[model samples]
Target: MSVVHLHLPGFSFGDVPVLGPLTLTVDRGETLALTGPSGIGKSTLLRIVAGVYPARGTREIAGRMAFVFQEPTLLRWRTAQRNVEIAAKVSPDTALAALTEVGLGACADRFPDQLSLGQQRRLALARAFACDPDLMLLDEPFVSLDAAAAEEMMGLFADLRARRNMAGILVTHDAAEARRLATRTLTLSGRPATVTADVHAAA
Candidate 1:
C-alpha cells in the first residue's frame, strides 16, 4: 500500500495562491524528490504533506512522520545527545547509536554551538533517524554543506532508509542530489505550482 496519497487541487495564503493540483503516491521505501526553483512552493508542498500547512486536499498518510529542515534546527543550549533525545523522544542509548550512525559518536556530548555546520547537520540527521519515522519530510536536507560532506550525508541517509524501509518526499534544487537519492522525481512549476514532470527510476 502507498505510504502517502495526495491529491490537492490547490492552496492559498489569504488571497495569494501558494500551491496545488499536486497529485502523487509514495510507496513504502520510496523516496520522491520535489524539485523546483526558489520560491516555487516546493517547501510549501512538503509542509502540506507533513501536516503543518492547511490546504485543500485529500491526504492519506499511513504512518508516523518526521521532518528535516534545510537548516539543522538543533537546540542551541542542548548537547548533541540531548537534542536527539528531546526531538526523537528516544532513549539515550538510541540517541547515541544514531549519532554513531551519522559519524558523530565522538561529539555526542558536545553542544550544538560547538559543532561545525556540517557536524550540526549530521546531528540533525541522527535525531531524525532516531525518531524511527515511517515517513520523512526533507526540505533541502543537504543544503549549505560542502560537496564532500553533502555526498557523505546523502549516503548515510540512503543507508538509513534502506535499514528502516521508510518513505520520503525530499525538496531540493540540486538535480544530482535528487537523482542520487530519490526513486522518482517530481518537478513543480508556475505561480501556484503543479507537478510538471514525473519520472521514475527502474529498480
Candidate 2:
C-alpha cells in the first residue's frame, strides 16, 4: 500500500490559523474522497500534491502521475484521439483503444468542441489513462454528468482501478461519490483550513 503524507501552511487570513501542515495518507488500490466547503483548498491540496504548487511541504507520490483538472483541459484544437496521442506514448492504435474503453472511439475524429460535457470529461479520462498513470488527481470528475452518466463514469473509474493498483485523491463536492468511491474520507476546516475529520470507510 502507498501512503501520502502532506504538510502545508497558509497565512493570508485575518485571524485564521494556518491551513495545515495538513497530513493524510491513502493506501494503494483505494480512493480518498476529499470534501469541504468552497475556498477551503480542496483543489489546492491536489494541485500541490500534483507538483503544480511550490508551497512548503514534503510529498511522496508513487508511480506515474496523471491529472484531470476541473475542466477537461483537452486541447480544443486537437481531435479527441490526438489529444491523448500528443501527451502519451500511445501509438495511433493504442490511442484508439483508450478512447474505446471510454466509449469515445466513434468520436475519434471529433474535436473537443463537438462533444458534450460528459463526453469531454470522458475524453479527458481517456487521455489520462493513455499515459498509464499509477496515480490520478481527479478534481470533480463527475461534475457535469447526470445521475446515470455519473454512475457510468464511476464504473469506468472502477474498471481503471481494477486494471492496475492505482490510487486516487478525488476532490469532489458529492458525498455520495465520497461514500461510493473512497475507502477513506477527510473534511477540512472552513476558514483557515485544517483536516477537521478523517474517516475510514468499510470496504
Candidate 3:
C-alpha cells in the first residue's frame, strides 16, 4: 500500500525557483531517502511532503505522520517525558514507555538543555514514537552527531521502523546513510531541483 503520494508542480521562494515539477510515492514500510548537494532543496522537499511548507502540488498522506528535524526541535521548558506526552498527546505512562524505548528513561525528568546531544536526539525519537506515526519525515536527523552516536541512532531508528512497519522519508547528504537506511534513494539536482536518480537498494 502507498503511504504517501506527492505531485509538486513546482516550489519557489519569492522569485527564486527551488524545485521543479516532481511526483513521488512511498509504499507502506518503505524508507525513501532524498539525497543531493547542500541547498539543493532536499529539506524543502521534505517539508512539502510533511505539509509544513506550501507549494503548488498535491499531497496525499495516509495515517499519522511525525517529523524529526535536523535539530531536536524540542520545547526547552518541558522535561524529556513531558515533551513526549505533550507532543504525542499521550498519557504519562505511555510517554515514559516511549522514552524507555529510546534509552531516555533515566533522563526523563531532565530538561532538554540538561541532556546530551545524543540523549536529546533520543528524546526526539521518543516523541515521534509516542505519537504512533505510520509515516515519519526526517530532515538530516543525525547531522551533528558523532560517528558512534549516529550509528546508534540509526540502529534505533531501524528497529523502531521495523517494529512499527512505518514508511519514512529521510533527507540527507550522506550516501552511506541512505544506502544503509533507505529501500530506495532519490537524488535531486539543478537550479530548479528535480529528481535525477532513483536507485532501489538490493534486497
Candidate 4:
C-alpha cells in the first residue's frame, strides 16, 4: 500500500528559491530516482519528504524509514558493526547481516577512520538497511567509487530490495544508477521543487 506522498507548496528563502512545488509519492516496494544537476535541490526534496524540510505541505508516510546522507556520517568512535547496531530498533544479528550483505562484514570491527571512503559509505548503507525500513531514503548513495565498484554496489542494492520488497527513494545524478535501481524516475522544478518528469517501468 502507498501511504506516503510529499506535497510541496513551493519554497523560497529571502531571495533564493530552492525547490519549486514538488509533489511526489513513494509507492510500496518501488524505487523513485530523483535526478537533477548540481544544486537543483534533489537532496533537499528528499529531506522534505523525510520530514526534515521546514517548508510547506504535509508528508504522508507510515512505518519506520531511514535516510542516508550524501556523506557517510557514521560515528567515528564506534566500530562499523557497533555503528550499525546503534539504533535500538536494529538487532545486533541483523546489523551484522546487513553489513555482510553489503560486503562489509570483515570491516565490521574496523573504525570509521580505518575504512576507506567506499567502505565507510557501505557501512552507512548497511546501517540503514539494518533498520529493515519500509521506506528507505537515499541521497547520492554512490558518490565516490570507480565505475565497476559503483555498478557492483548498485547490483547489490537491487538484489537486496528485490529479496526484501523494500521501497527506496533515491536522489542521484547518474542515469545508470537510476535505470538500474529505480522503478520510476522524476525531475524536479522550482524552489520547493515540483515534479517535472515522471517515468515508471514495469516489474
Model number with the top lDDT? 3
lDDT of 2: 0.83
> Which ten residues in a row are the worst by lDDT in model 4?
187-196
What are the runs in model 4 whose C-alpha is more than 4 Å off? 190-193
lDDT of 4 by residue, 16-47 (tens): 88877656777788889998777888887788
Of 1 and 3, the candidate ahead on TM-score is 3
Higher-scoring candidate on lDDT, 1 or 2: 1
TM-score of each: 0.96, 0.91, 0.98, 0.92
Error of 3 at 40 (Å): 0.3
Clashes of each: 1, 0, 0, 15
Candidate 1 weakest lDDT stretch, 10 residues = 15-24
Displacement of residue 178 (Cα, Å) in model 4 is 1.0
List, residue by residue over 9-41, the lDDT tens digit for candidate 3.
Answer: 999999999999999999998999999999999
* lDDT ranking of the models: 3, 1, 2, 4
What overall lDDT goes with each candidate model? 0.91, 0.83, 0.94, 0.82
Cα RMSD, model 1:
1.1
Which candidate model has the greater lDDT, 2 or 3?
3
Which stretches in model 3 have alpha-carbon errors above 4 Å? none
Q: In model 3, state the lDDT of residue 21.
A: 95
Residue pairs with backbone atoms closer than 3 Å in model 3 (clashes): none
Per-residue lDDT, model 2, residue 97, is 97
- Of candidates 4 and 3, the better by lDDT: 3
